[model samples]
Structure formats: structure tokens, C-alpha cells
Target chain A: MDPDTAIGGGRDRFPSTEHSLLEAAAGGLAPEALERVAALYWKPVYRFIRLKFHKDNEDAKDLTQGFFSSALERDFFARFDPSKASFRTYLRMAVERFAWNAHAAGKCRKRGGDVAFEPVGEDAALTESPEEAFDREWRRQLFRLALRDLRKLCESAGREVEWRVLEAYDLAEDARPSYAAVGEQLGIPETSVTNYLARARRTLRKLVQDRMRGVTSGERELREEMRRVWK
Target chain B: MEVNSDPADLSDSVVDHLRQVAGLPDLSGTRYELEGEIGRGGMGVVYQARDRQLERRVALKVVEAALAGEAALIARLEHPAIVPIYEAGTLPDGRAFYAMKRVTGVRLDRYAGAGRPVAERLRVIRRVGEALAFAHSRGAIHRDLKPQNVMVGEFGEVYVMDWGVEAVGGTPGFRAPEARLDQRSDIYALGALLQFVLPAPAPAALSAIARKAMSAEAGCRYGDVEEMLADIGRFEDGLAVTAWREPPMHRVARFWSRNALLLWLLTAYAAVKLGIFFWPYR
Candidate 1:
């Protein structure tokens, strides 16, 4: 099956430029839209291809890049029906469909270009359900994205203390330090430490929710995805 | 198009901690203080919290499955059998949260399993149906009704819960096949709830009522929850139910069973009068 097989024919009917691919053929691919979609989904897509399709790391990376690149070229995201399933479920189903097509095609050739991620050669076994693992990887990436944004926001706004406190309190890998101790190290009172921690966490939560909102349009879908991400 | 954030120290523990912080409801501006998590559902976590101003413990639900819709819907619905929302507002993260009367009770499914009499379980369903009736009167359909969404208190208070306003969603078995929800759709779920409550080898009359209400065609089912409750009322009163057409012998048996004591007294008096009337000495 070719890339267009995932979406049925009669592509000439869409009324707006919002459904790309046809628009991509006219102007060019929407690079920002394509990049945002790929940025959030590529890790899970790669991991899912490796486990569910039994593809090697290199092949899974190729399919991951191929699927997203093709997704833009064929107006895949616009065809999603939120009523039938959540976007997460829809994405999973689409990845499986793409993988099956690749398997049937004997080999899924590299579509866009070389993948930017290096495949970890040693760790390839499944430790959990592939769907759950995919969800976890997606969530991990979401948090990573939010964290990255939090750092940039803190730096730009000259609120580095808030980021440092959040990093020290919530993001600590070892046993977290007491509020008083963290205050002593950061040269602030314990009360200010408490206030800063609350402020930073509040910001982080909003940032994470904003990231969630970026994916789905509906309020209900956003809330459901919020619960799912936390779970 | 590029992958980053690999070496930034988001290990499993860090992820768990970050998720915990994200899930925590920020109650800085509210009158409630979080104690701990009570439980979670499809929507969000319910926390056991204290209302410092009211000096009462309330169940605080931090909404995640909907924006403000669930809380607002719940706040509008006020019935003794329906759980009442006391106060609602947005959390710091912009998710809605509401404080409600902290109900101490068993879910209807577990309560039904505890060797209770069939009459007692039927009564629980009646209260649930009444709550739905009140909601319907206010132009709201529960859309999702099941045994799990109902709670039976120690003093027999019934609280119908988890009233979220949404579209095209429900638990599978309890949900009616009809896509568009109306009063009848809730009737369908109540029927399923009744079926869940019934013990195996249930009374045939009650079983027939459940089956009729659960008919695949929505029109074939009870017109509304109140109408269904009336059928249950008929069964409880030893009268024929609208759902089931009792056969000739069963009707006779039921009549006899209902009037057995009076019939025996009348028959004995008539035998004595006849003996005195036909006595040879007279």
C-alpha cells in the first residue's frame, strides 16, 4: 500500500487549507505544523514500531520518520475523528496501520530523510505492554517538553530562582531536600522557599496542560488526556 | 524534527514525582486543605479534604475529564438521593474542582452483594430512579447510570454520583444502544442497573421487568424512570406489572396467595352456618 492508502481517495474535495498535503502540493509542507506533530509523537511512534511490529531499532526509526513525513504529505491528522476515539488511541491505531502496510510492502523505505535519533543498540526487549509503553514514552516526552519550556521561560523572564527551586524540589532524583535546607542553599527564607515552590509548580502544571491543549481541540478531550497523562 | 531532552535527568523517579506534582490540586485560594487521595475515576482523583471555614470534611473532586461542565451540572442538580455539590472553582492549573458532601457508603454493586433482601435492593434502585426523574424534570439526562455510580449509605441514604455532561459516552453494558440520549436512555441504564442488582435465580416477575426495560429498541423499554419505578411498585404491591403479562395459573396463584387468609376465614364461617341450618334437632 502506498502512503495515500491510509486515507481514502477523493483528496481534491477538502474545502480549506487546514487539511494539508493538497496544500503542501501547492505551497510546500507546513514545516512548523509538521515539526510540532513530529516532536511530540516521534519517540512513542519509534518505540511502538520496534515492539509491536518486531522491527529493529534502525528500521523502527525509519518507519517513525516515514510515517510522520507521510502523515503530513497525505493530510492524516485532519482525518482524525475525535468522537470515535481519543487522539492517543487514534494515533496508535494509525501507527499500527502504517506498520502493517510497511510489512506488506516487504520494506518501508526511508521517505523524508535520515532520523535524528540514535537507536540504543542494547535495550530492545519489552518490559511492559506495548501500548502502555507507548503512552509512557509519550508522557515522558510531554514532561520533558514542558520542563524545557519552563527553563526557557524562567531564563527569559529572569525568574531563574523559581526554576532552580522547582528543579531542586520536584525534579530531584535523590531524596528531596527539606524546604528549609533548600532555602538555606538558595539564600532565601524557608517561607519564601515554600512560596516559590508553589508558584513554580503552579506554572509547571499550567505549562503541561497547555502542552496537552496543543494536541487536541475539544475541552473534554483535553481533560481526558490530562487524566490519562497523569495516570 | 529534532529529538532532545534525553540527558536532562528525567529518570523514572523524577517522572513519578513530576506527575504527582502535576496531579496535585492547588487549593491555595480555596477554603479546603487536601488530606490525601480518596480514589480516582475516569475523570479525576477524589481527595479527602477539610473545609476549614465550614469545619466539615468534604469530598473534593479535582476535575480532569471535563472542564467546568461536570461540576456545574452537579451543582445544578440538588436532590436527597443525588450527591450535592457545595462549592466549585478552578484550580491553579485551570482545571475545575468541586467540594461535595462526603458520603460514607458502599457502592450499589457491593451493597447488593451483601446478602440483602431483594426488597431492600429494589428500594435502592427506586431511590436512584427518583433521582434520575428529578434530573430529567430539570431537562438533564444522566446518560450514564450504572450500579457503580450509585452509593447506599448506612442509614439508607442513596446518592447518585458522577453526573458529567458529555456526548456519546457511557459504560458499555449499562449504556443504551440508542446514540442520542433522552429520558428513555437513562431508563435503559436503570434497567441494566436493576439487572446487575438482581441475584441469580431472581423472582421471575422482577426479572421480567428488568428484561422489558432493557429491550434493545428504546421505545420498547419503559417510557421513563418514573414509569419503570411504577412497575417495580406494582411488583412490590403484589399487583401485575406492566412489563409482564402473567399467565392464567400464575394470576390465580397470585390472587390466592394475596387473599388466602381471608378466604380461609370466610369458608370456615360458611361451613358452621350450614351445619347449624341442616341440624336434625331443628
Candidate 2:
């Protein structure tokens, strides 16, 4: 079943920007909208090509850039049907098919020009199947984008202490410092550290949920995606 | 430090994502300094904090930014069974949070499973009932009452936490099958709590009380928490409970069950007397 149907009759409760991006993509790939969509999905696409297709990093990066550059010119996103599949699944399938066609035509020529996408690391486990690799990379990208947004929010709001506390307490868990230690480092009371961490966590959860709207079909899918991303 | 090549776990990924996000300095201007996370639920995350002015530890429940309006309402509830909210306010980032006494104890279900005597369990339940009774008197209904929401404190304090989600989200298994939740719904949850605390094959008197509280028809349940508390009190004092009318045969059977060994010896003596009486004839 289409995940949208499971989320109660495809009522789009997400913000209008996501819908507008798709509409623009369908109406003839407006440059600004296509760029936004590309920026959002490029990391996942590049990682999928590198890990799933076994292409070297440079070739994978060039192919990812080439696919999006061509997809914009050829109106690739117009083919996406919300009733058929989620945007994430559709994009993954589209990228995979693009890779196969490129290899078939022997046109794997470098054409990235000035795209400058982030490099795909070699750390992804090779044991995963293509679908698993695509999904893991996609979720990782979503997390990366959401984190970027959260940083912007914190910077805008001047909550740097809360952000630092969260970084020390949550992100540095391998060598996790006690709240008292973080407090001493920050020159604040331990209780303040705890409060800041809680605030940061709550804000991050909201921001991640907001970012998930672009890919999820509806509220149910959004919730499911959030659970998977944060699980 | 060596970085692991494998992908980060879900929790680690979340933390990494948070770290990457732009952070803000401490913007809250509250009296309490947060210590650490105490617990979390569907509505909010609670932190253990120290109230600087009061010089005491408190559980600060920071609710979702959208649900900040509930903090004041929850703060108004002043009952021993309910965690008393001392202060409520919005953080600089607009999330709603409140401070209440930090209850140090396990959840009710965990406390019940600790092999405590039945009397102790009943006493704890009674205290909880008293708390609920107080809330009901103040026209507050704890629509989300459950074993998890009830805290059994270290010094035998019974506190019912998480009143923010009252009349909103009900636990699937504990909620009554009612169109509109009211005091009866809380009563049903209390009945469920009794079943959770009582061991299998609970004594007939207590089971009857639980059954009446969990009656399918709302009208058939106790008139109020006070009535239920009264029945529990009666049971504790060895008086006949109002929940069930004991039939003459049932009472006799219960008495016999309670003193089975003594009854068996008396019966054996009677049988021997009869046998001796008949021995002369034999």
C-alpha cells in the first residue's frame, strides 16, 4: 500500500514549501526550486551512487551532479506520483535507474562542472544491500540537513550555551562527561547544564520533524520517519 | 581519539545532528537550575533541577512549545498525591515548563512487583485514592491515570505525575470505553491499577472492589473516589466492604477458608467422639 493511504487519505499537512517545490518541478523545473530540491537530496544521491553502485568517490560525485543537472533539464521529478510512492523512495529509484542508463549508454563522462557536492565517505558498510544503503544514506542526509537548520535556529536565537551543553552531553557520549563536568567547563551550575540540554533536545526534535515534512507523505509518515531517523 | 568507521547508532545520530545544529546560550531566566533528565512522556520531558530560591530539588516538566498553556492549569493542582507544581513559565525559546517536587521512587507497577506484603500495597493504593479524591474534590479529573504515572516515593509518598495530558491522551489499555472521559474514566484507571498491584487470585473482598470500580457501565461504578476509598478503608479495618454483599454461605465458607487447619482439627475430634460413642454398639 502507498504510505500516504495508510496516513489517512493523503491529506498534506506539511508546510506549503514542499508542495510548491514538487509543483515547480512538474511545471517545468524552475531553477530556484530545482536547486532547493537538489541541495536537499544531493548527499543521499551521491552516497547511493558511491556505496550502492560501487563507483569510486570522484565518479560517484560526478555522476550525482550530472544526474541532477540532466534531471533538471529533462524534468525528472514530473514523473513522481505521491499515490505511487514517497518522495524519498521515488528519488532513490530515479537515481538508481539514472545510474544504470548512464552505464548502459557508456556516457559516464565527467560533467559536474561547478556543482561542489559534499564528498561521500567510504565508511558505509559494504554488507548492506543497495536498498539498505540508499535508505541509510537518505536518513543520514535528512539528519545532517535538520542539524544545520537547528544550528541556524540556535544562532538566530542566541542560545549558544544550550547548544554547547547539548553537544558536550549528547554528542560526546563516547567520552560522555558528567553534567557536573560540563557545568565546570561552561562555568555554570550543573542544574543549568541539565536545563540547557533538555531545551536543546526539545528544539532539535521539533526542527527534525519540520525538516522531515519535505520527504514524508503525511502526519503518519512524518511520525514514522521521525521515529526511524531518531530511533 | 579514534573515530569508528561504522555508522552511528540512532541515538548517536540524533546527538550528532543536535551538535551540528546552531546552539544558543542559556536564555531561561528561571529560579531553578536543571540537573539532569528524570523521565519523559508523550507530552513532555522532565528534568531533575534544583530550585535556587527554595534550596530543594524539583522535577521540572518542560512541555512541548505548542502545549505551554497547560503548565498553569497543572500548577494549580495542590494535592499530596499529585506532584505540586511550584512554578510555571515559558522558556526564552517559547517552550512551556513547570517545576514540581522531585519524587524519588519507582513507578507504581515496579513498586508493586517488589514482593511487598499485600497490606503495604493496599496502604499505598489507599494513599493514591486519597490524592485522587482530593483532586476530584477540586473538580480535577486525572483522565490519564495509570501505573506508570503513579510514583511510589522513597519515604512511602504516593504521587500521581503527568496531569498535563489529562482529558487529552489516554493510555490504550487503561482508558475506559467511554465516549467522553470524566471522573469515571479515572475510576476505571484506578481499578486497572488495583489489578496491577494485586497478585493473581486476589482476595475476594479486594477483587470485588476492583470489579465494581471497573464496571462496564459508568453509573455502576463508585459514585466518587471517596466511596472507593471508604470501601478500601473498610477492607483494611476487617469490616464488610460496600463493593460486595457477602452471602451467608460465602461468609461461612470464607471463615472456614481462613481457619481451615483449626476447623479440620475440630472436625477430626468430632469424628473421633462419634466413633467412640459408636464403639460400644459395635
Candidate 3:
């Protein structure tokens, strides 16, 4: 089916020169339209979540559904801007922020902190049979596959200077060590830790953006994705 | 040293290096007789070739002009369902090359469409599903899941052909309606495959299920591969040989979209109000 007539048709199209789609999305297109637009980009968001969260498919699906629901919330839409960055950048930034918030809250919950969990959104109205649904989940594992490939690529290039730091801390936030501690672990001075992290962060960010290239468009969008990771 | 990365660059220098390495012949006695190209796509080109050392035929796939970085990623994988990469090095032309056990079979499409018996076709589809399920369980997602890429050997071995197109399951048209294409998207595509292979007597209920499974919207599909697999098991166990077109709930969701809105609004109001009152005190 052509995506145009569905809610996505009205939401946004690619190579978004200006942020007209962002504007429409901000203004509240119909729920169907939101779904249409979300459909176009959900894969990237979900992949990022899978890589960041270390959660399996069931959890990934819940988080992903939650992400879209969060995006549609009144406050989220109200705060969005087109001129600031591309949609891909905006979406990735949103995911990073959301994950940080969610992780922080989960930690709070573990501490006997009574943080209320909002019922963000309803379940997706999926129609495929059990067999078909199985196929989709299998396909979803591509992110891990891609990550594995990326790890090997880096190793072969002998670009080990900072990738170790990235691999260690990027997957799980809790395991992150202070710069002094990292320097001790790697047997480098504390000052060199900062340099390692800076270089590592840049390389990690570049690796992700390069893989993501061609799947989207334009140099600006790629830069936007780079900006998004730290967001 | 850090990989020299210019932000605008997609050129995979790592792959380029590997291609250079391949030129040196890591396999002391093996000379690869490059033959005519059998297939080509965005990632690499597959050529029918002779592995002189093995004294047998094999396929050598040289990395495309792009995707030079994939040299490292593809080289590590070892699975029955995947096309195995035996060695990774560079070709004389400064392109990365990998050799795998060349496959001989018909594309799934040939055996999947009309004129085939329903039972046999469904069996083939099930094998495809199992192979994909196996891969996912091992933490791999074949983002490019389509009939053309699926190879069905003479003995019915189903090999899912590509991973070069893979990323974190976000690219559309590859996985289920949910984000980060999971096992469920493979199931949905398999469902689509069933539609391609089976006759008209197949149920509309199945199609609705397939449509939802393959939904462009990630949030509208099944949660994972296992759930879908369970449903398929129930389906096959019952094997509604008669092929019923419409199930009752399918009718309800269609006619009820108008009412679906009303119900959603009533629920949303309650949720938001309650959410506001119970909002986290931060």
C-alpha cells in the first residue's frame, strides 16, 4: 500500500528540507497520521533502544511502544522544533533522553522509591498470525548482528585506542567508571582518560552514523544523528 | 590509533585494507579461479569460482565498492542457516573478498507461489521460519527477509542469504510493525510468503493477520517471534484445511474503528487524569 493516504501520507516525507513534517507533528496530526509517520522511522528508534537497553525482544517491544506513545504525549509534541535539527536527530535525542529518565526511575524503584509508572500507551493493533509475528522478531535481531559486525570491523582496523572505553560503558550505564578509575584500569594517567573518552566517543558516534548512512539522506541528517547520541 | 573518520565519509577503509590483505594469498596453495558473476547487490558481488586447493567449485563474493567495513563483521559468523565466510582478505583490486560454501538451489519464490500444493509449500515456509527463529535466538536479525534472498536447496534446506543490509531492526519493510525488527517481523514476512505460495482458499483471517504482521507501523504488530510462533503452532495444529475467510474479531475491529475512537477517548481521559494526580513528584 502507498504510505501517502494513510496517516503517514499526511505526516512527513523524506529529505525533509525544512521541518514542515516536524511542524505538523508538533501541531498534532491525527493518531493515524502519527502512526504513519512513526512507521517510517520506528526501526531506527527501536534499534537504538535494543543496543542501549540490553533488553530482549519482549522488553524491547514494550519500550519501543512506550517511546512512540511518549512522543505523542502533548508535552513532547509541544516542545519539538524543526529548525534546530533533522527528524532523525530529534528522534534519537528523544530516545536517549527517555532511556536515561527511564533508567533513573528504575533505579529509584529499586531503592524502595515509590515512583509511579504512567500507563503511557496502548498495545499495537498487530494482525499477523503467530508464525508471521515470529518472523518479525527474528528480523529485529539485526541490530545485534550489526553491532557484532561493527565490533569486528573496528578490531580489524586496529582502532583499539578508544573503542574499548566505548564498548565498556556504552552498553550499560551503571558499569561506567570515573575517569580516574578508567585511567587506573587502562594503566594510563587520569588526564589521558579524558582524551581516550573524547576520541572514543567521537569514533563510536561515527561508527553508528556511518552504518545509518544511505538508509536516510543528506549530510545534515547525519550530523544531526551525531549530535543526538550525547543528547 | 582511532580510525580516521571524517563525518561525511561512508567509505569503509577497513574493508579496503582487508581487500589488500586478501591479495597476498593467506591460503598458501589455494588459487581462486574467478569466474563469471552470478549475483550482485548493494553489498558485494557473487562469482562462481573454482577453489584450486579444494579442487572443487565454490562461490567467491567480493565486497561491493561500498561496505568495505563489513569485512570484519561477516567474517566472524558461523551458522548453518547463514552463508559461512571461510576466509577474509582483500582481492588484488583493493576490494575485500570472502569465500563461502556456494549454494545451489531455487529461490523461494519459484516454489512459493500458486500451482504448488498447499501442504508442501507450508512445509517449506515453516522451515524458513525455523531457520530464522534459530538465527534470532542466537542474537542475529536478517533485516532483509524476502523471497528473493531465501534459497531453497534441492533437499529443501532453506538458507537466508544476506546480512549486509542488516542494522538495528529499524529499517522499514524488513521487520514487524514493532521497533527494532525482531523475530516477529520474520514471522510476518513468512506469512506473506505463505500468501505467495498458497492458493486462494487461504483465509482472509490469515491475510489480516499477515497485514498486521507486516504492518508499516512497527507499533501495530506482534510483540516478538515466539508469540507469533505460538500462534502459528495453534494454527497448524488446527490446520483449518477448509480455509475460512473471516474470523469474528476481524469484523469487529474493522467496523469498530469509529467506536474504537470513542472507547480510546474515554480510556485516555481516565488515564491522563489519574496519571496527572499520581504523577511522579519530581
Candidate 4:
């Protein structure tokens, strides 16, 4: 594949591991990998349908789920050539193509065929282009998965206080409590609140990076992706 | 809320996830309000925000929590080429964020990419050199000095950014081949930037200067940004650059090259006058 096809520069030196995911799926060594791919991309596909294709939420959800099930059954990933494009771009193109074919066949609302993907709702207004919406949704999905993992980590480690502190301060848009306020609310000292939040942010950042690495093509692309995610 | 398996709840959670990933801080209580993201780097993301108390817009760089200390240190740097930090504080989440003067212009790479005149590009690079010189004088090294890290304002102002990653490490392809990074490493990066902005087959004198700055051996590069700036100044003034040892023939060629238009005009004038003078003789 033309390394430059990936996002950032220095692709020649640092190849991304995303290709391996495709390879594993194509080789049939791991059905779980394909399932993971479906889980990661389903929301972005659904969002693309709703925003770009102008489908309603219910129709978008059905089309998204149906597309994934059909693609998996047909071994769609095996046809992907990383040399031709980055996995993100390739997957986006595949989703668009699948949606187009389904629409042509008048199967946009045919539900219960297979692949019962989770229902993801449309949140923000469609202010961006379809491509922009797809990219943004992709990033949101990555963050959501990373956050879920972070929550698991916190629960296992008995760091509910830290998790709550982060949720209040980082996640809450209304009444974002200060460190002192969070401390008072949680019955901890302000200094401890600061330390816990710091810990949580660090852990979250690492988890985000780890999740990004799974999809990105190389170190440079990973850094570029992370920068975009933060931006 | 009871155990809810409602699809609407799932959708609400998705919206909540979007809010967190948006990285928009609730600055309603703070003096600054988030406007939008202007730029981003590995260390931090910069948002264009309005300082409500000050009634002005500023660029707020909110770094990852781990780099908070570095952000604070960068706020202390004062230079014309460096983006001036107006204030430093933490988000409620404890991430280190600082407000700086919001510059309205493109990155140096983009600015240079527009095919601006060579002189203008050099001027921008010189401003960056001035910033680096001041920084090194203050015992700080800008380890990352690529074109992306430099911003050029609409009014011809230049500002260096992302000091949060300063002296931390260098960007790939710009990193010096040295175990210990210091002032010379920045000089090397300046050389890379010069190569990036300068036209292909750059003037012999300027290419030599870039070569010296990007020398493999750290000691071989310019000792400081000022010295490199001086060489650039000399090159701009049509004088022999310190970086290049021009032979007499090459110096004459360079002189001709610099004054090619004037020389062409002079040659035309002389030919016209000579033709008139020889008219009667003929």
C-alpha cells in the first residue's frame, strides 16, 4: 500500500497495525476480530446514514446493522487491500457502497435479517459534511470504547471516587464542578481530589491511545489520530 | 433511575459520549469561554476562547494532565516571536491550560506553501530564529522547531507555539542525530524548516547555510540561532554568507545573479547608445 495513503507522514518508516486486523479477518483466524471491527465501525456507519444519506434514526439503525451482517457473511474484509487505502477510508467507502446497494434494492428498512448491533442515537445537529460527520462519529466511537474500558479498569481497581471526580469535571457540561467542589461533594480533601482526577486523566489518555493504536496504521498515524481526537 | 434497557437510554448515552469526546469545557464559571479548537499537537490542544473579563479573544492551550507542569513552564516564556501567555490555570478536570494571544494566520508550512516571495519566507524564518535565540538565552531549548510549530499572523507577525513539547523531543525527520538535545538541535530543525520553505535547488549560498545548520555533528552546526540569523541577513543583503566559502568566480556569478535585471537594462542602454554612436561612422 502507498504508505502516504494512511493519514500522516513518515508512513514508510512506521507501518500501522490496522492492516493486521484485516489480514486476521481475511485469514479466518479470528472471527472475533471481524466482530470487533463491526462493533467499532457500526456507529460511524449509522451516523453516516442518518446525516449523510439523510435517513431517519430507525431506518439508519436498521441499514447499519443489516450492512454489517451482510458484509460479514460475504467476507467483505477479505476483499480489502490495505495497499490501496487506509482501513478507515476503506471501511467508510465500503459502508457507503453497501448502503447504496441496499437502497437500490429497496432494503433500507428491512430489519431482523441478522447482526443485532446496539442502537446508537443521533446526538448533535448535522452542521458538518457527511465525510466530516463520519470522521467525528468514528472518533466518538473510539473514545466511547476507551471510556468503557476505563470504567472497567476503575471498577476493578476500586477507584470509583476517581472515576466520579473525572465524570463530574471532564464529562459534565452543566455545572462542571471545581476540584474543591468535587472534593466536598465526594467527601475527600481538595488535594486528594486533584490527585485522583490527575490519575484518572492519565489513565484515560493512555486507554485512548491504546484504542487508537488498534485502528491506526502506524505510530505517525496514531499520533496524528490522537491529535485530531484531542483537537 | 431503575434498570433501564430502553433504546432511548442507549441513544442518550451515545450523546453523553459525544459530549465528553468533544472536549468542550464548561467555562461558564471561568473567566474564559471555549470558542473552538484552533490547533493541536501531541502534548496539547489549543482552543480559541474569549476572555470574558478581559473582553478579548485568546488561544487557550489545554494540555494532557501529565504535561501540566510543562505548560506552566511554557507560560513563563516571554518573546515577540513566542505566543505570549496571558494566563495559566487548570480546567475543573485538573488539566493544565493556558491562555495566549490568539494569532490569526496560517502555520508557517501553510504560509510558505502558498508560494510567497522568497524574501518574505526568509523574514518569517528570521523571526522564528529571533524567538529561538531569546529562548536559548533564557536557558530554554525549543527541541521541536519544524514549520508546523511556527505561526505567521496576517499582519506579518510570527509566533512560535507548542512549547509544551519543547526540549521534550523532536519531530520525526527533524530530530538531530545526537544523544543529547540542546540549542544545536533547534538549529538543525531551523535548517529543516529552511529546506521545507525554500525553493528547490535553493540559492547556493542559502543551501550552504542550511547545510551548516543541519550538520550531522552537533558541534558543526551554528552555535546559536543569532549566528544563523546573521548568515541569513548576509545572504539577503547580497553579501557573501558566512556559511559558504564562495570562490572569486562564484562571488562574481552571485553578484551578476543578484543584479541580473539591472545588468540587463544597462547592457540594453549601452547597446542602444553604441549603435547611435556608430551610425555616423557607418
Number of the top DockQ candidate: 1
- The TM-scores, one per candidate, come to 0.86, 0.58, 0.40, 0.53
Tens digits of per-residue lDDT for model 1, A67-90: 877886666766777778887788
What shift in Å separates residue B24 of candidate 4 from its native position after superposition? 4.1
Clashes found in each candidate (C-alpha, N, C closer than 3 A): 0, 10, 44, 3
Q: Tens digit of lDDT per residue, candidate 1, span B166-267?
A: 643689998888888777888888999998999888878898999998898998998888889999999898889988888999999889888899999999
Task: Evaluate every candidate with DockQ and list the scores.
Answer: 0.32, 0.07, 0.01, 0.05
- For model 4, the stretches where C-alpha displacement exceeds 4 angstroms are A1-231, B1-28, B113-115, B166-169, B255-282
Candidate 2 regions exceeding 4 Å error are A1-139, A150-206, A212-231, B1-28, B53-55, B166-169, B178-180, B216-220, B237-247, B253-282
**A67-125, model 4: which lDDT tens digit per residue?**
76677677676776654566778888888888888675664455547434434334545
**Candidate 1: Cα lDDT at B56:** 95
After superposition on all CA atoms, what RMSD does each candidate show versus the true structure? 7.1, 10.8, 27.4, 12.4
Residues B117-180 of candidate 2: C-alpha lDDT, one tens digit per residue: 8998998888878877887776766778788998888888888887744344488767888868
**Residue range with the least summed lDDT across 10 consecutive positions in model 3 chain B:** B1-10
Residue B87 lDDT (model 1): 86
Scored by CA lDDT, what does every candidate get? 0.76, 0.68, 0.52, 0.71
- Model 1 chain B: weakest 10-residue lDDT segment is B1-10
Q: Residue pairs in steric clash, candidate 1?
A: none
Model 3, range B1-282, lDDT digits (tens) per residue? 232232111122332222222222222223777665677543456777788878877777765324556445545556566677766666433446777888899898776766777667666666666666766676655665777777888877777776643333333444445545555566666656656666777655455556655656655656665555555554555432122355667556545653677888989999999999999993
The C-alpha stretches of model 1 lying farther than 4 A from their native spots are: A1-30, A104-127, B1-7, B42-44, B64-66, B275-282
Candidates sorted by TM-score, best first: 1, 2, 4, 3
